[model samples]
Target: MALWALVSAVGLAVDDRVLVGAPIWAKPFKFFVSFAAYGLTLAWMLAQTTWGRRTGWWAGNVVVLTSLVEMVIITGQVIRGKRSHFNAETPFDASLYTVMGLTIVVLWAATLVIAALLLRTRLADRATAWAIRGGVLIALVGAGLGFLMAQPTAEQRAAGNLDTADVIGAHSVGVPDGGPAMALTGWSTTGGDLRIPHFVGMHALQLIPLFLIALVLLAPRIARLGDARVRLRLIRVATAGYAGLVALTTWQALRGQPLVHPDAPTLMAAGVLLPAVAAGVWAALRTAPEPESVRTKTEPASDSKEFTA
Candidate 1:
C-alpha cells in the first residue's frame, strides 16, 4: 500500500491530466496513503487483542483483501482516466463503481468485526485500552459516513439524470464536484464537502492512539500525567472530545456549510465543546492521586530510611 502511494506520488508529479478539478492521480494517492495507515493500524490491533485473536486475525485479513480490491478498482480507473466513484457514464464504469462500493462495504464490515473483538479484549493499561477501543468505535462511525456520499445528489435526481448521469453522487453538497477545491486534498472550498467529515472520522484509529502515545511520552515531564488514573481520565476526555469533533464536522457538512466558513451555530457548538473538554481535563488532573514519585518523596523520613535498608 505504501509503495502504491509512492507510485501515485510520482504520477501526481508527472501526470498533467486533471479530473474533477484536481490531478487524476490525487484520489488514488490519498486512498493509498490512507490504506497504508489503516492496514498497519489494524495489524497492530489484531496483535493487541487476546481473547478473540483468531476471529480478529481473520477479520483483519478480510479488511486487507477488501481494501486491496477497492484500491485496484481505483487505480485502474485512474489509468483509464475515468472517475472511480459516482461515475456511471458507461455500463462498464457503472459496474466497476458498483464493485468498488461492494468491496468498501465488505471492508467496513470486517473493520466492525475487528472492533467488536477489540472491545472484548482486556489490557492492563487503561489509557491504551480506551485509546484502541474508542479509536476503533469512532473510526467505524467515520467510515460509515462515506455512505452519505453514495446517494445521488439532489441536482441529479431533480434533473431525472440518476441512471443516465455521468456522475451519480457527489462529495460536495451545495456545489458540484470538480469546482474550486483546496489544494492537494481537493476538498471543496466554496461549499460543504462530505469528504471533510469522512476523512476526519476515518482516521480516528490513528489520531487517537497517537494522542495517547503523546500523553505517555509527556508523563515523565508532567507529574499528574504519570498517574495511571489521571492518564485514563485524560484519555477518556480526549476520546470524547474527538468524537464530538467528528459529530460537529459531520453536522457542519450536512448543513451545506464549508468547514472554514462555519456559521454562528457551528461556532457556538465549538465554543461549548472547547470549554467542556477543558473542564474535563481540569477535573481529571484535580481529582488524580499524587504521582508515585511525589508520594515516595513525601514519605516520612523514618519510612524512607527503613526502605533504604
Candidate 2:
C-alpha cells in the first residue's frame, strides 16, 4: 500500500489538470494512500484475532478484489478525462459509477463481518480487543455516511442540468461540486463538506489502535499500572471521545460551515468535550493498580498471558 501511494504521488506530480482545475490524478492518489493505510491496519488487527484460516483467506480475497475494482474504475476515469464519482456524462460513465458503488458495498460488508468476528473472539489482550472493536464500529459509521453522499441534493435536481443517467450524488454540499478547497485535503472552505467526517471516521482503525500503542510506549508506567480490564475502560473512554469528535465534525459540516470557520456553538462544544476527555483519561490512569512487574513472580499466569497477547 505504501508503495502504491508513492506511485500515485508520482502520478499526481505529472498528471494534467481536469475539469475541476485540480490534478486529474489527485483523487486516485488520495484513495491509494488512504486505502494503503486502511488495508494494512485491518490486516494487522485481523492477525490478532482467532479467525480460522479459510475465513481469513476469504476475507482477504474480498478486500483485495473490491479495492482493485474500485481503484481501477477511478483511475480509468481519470485517464479518460472524466469524473470517477457522481459522473453520468454518458452511459459508460454511469455504469462505472454504479459498479464502483456496488464494490464499496461489498467492501463494507466484509468489514462488518470482520468486526463481528473480532467482537465474538476472545482476544488475550483486553485493551487491544476494545481498540479493534471500537475502531471497526466507528469506521462502519463512517462508511455508512457514504450513503448520505449518494443521494443527490435538492440543488442538483433543481439545476435541471443533470441527465437521467446521473443517479449518483456528490461529496460537497451548499456549493457546486469542485469549488474552492483547502491546500492538501481539498475540503471546501466555502461550503459544508461531508468528506471531512468521512475521512476522519474511516481512519479510526489506524488512529485508535496506534494511539493505544503510543500510550503504552510513552507512558509505560501508567499502562503497566492497569490490568487489562482497567486498560479496556481507558480505551472505551478514549474511543467515546473520538466518536464524539467525528459526530461534531459531521454536525459542523451539515451546517454549511467549513472546518476552518467554527461558530460559537462549535467552540463551546469543544470547550466542554476537551476537559471531559482529559478528566476521563486522568481518572482512568490514576485509579489503576500498581504495576504487576512489582508483584511476586509466582503471581497468576493470567497477567503474563495478557501482556504477551
Best model per lDDT: 1
Off by over 4 Å in 1: 290-309
Candidate 1 minimal-lDDT segment of 10 residues = 290-299
Global fold similarity of model 1 (TM-score): 0.93
**C-alpha positional error of residue 244 in candidate 2 after TM-score superposition, expressed in Å:** 0.3
| After superposition, candidate 2 runs with Cα above 4 Å error | 51-53, 160-168, 219-230, 291-309
Q: What is each predicted model's overall lDDT from 0 to 1?
A: 0.90, 0.81
lDDT at 99, model 1: 94
- Cα distance off (Å), candidate 2, residue 201: 0.4
217-307 per-residue lDDT for model 2 (tens digits): 7555655434555576688888999999999989988888888889999999899888989998878766656555754466666666677
Q: What is the TM-score of each predicted model, taking all chains together?
A: 0.93, 0.88
Mind giving the per-residue lDDT tens digits that candidate 1 earns over 1-309? Answer: 999999999999999999988999999999999999999998998899888788887898899899899999999999999999999999999999999899999999999999988888899898899999999999999999999898987778889947678888899998899888887788888888999889998899999999888988998998887888898998899999999999999999988888888899999999999999999999999875753554335556665567674
Pairs clashing within candidate 1? none
Candidate 2 C-alpha RMSD relative to the actual structure: 6.6
Model 2, residue 303: C-alpha shift (Å): 35
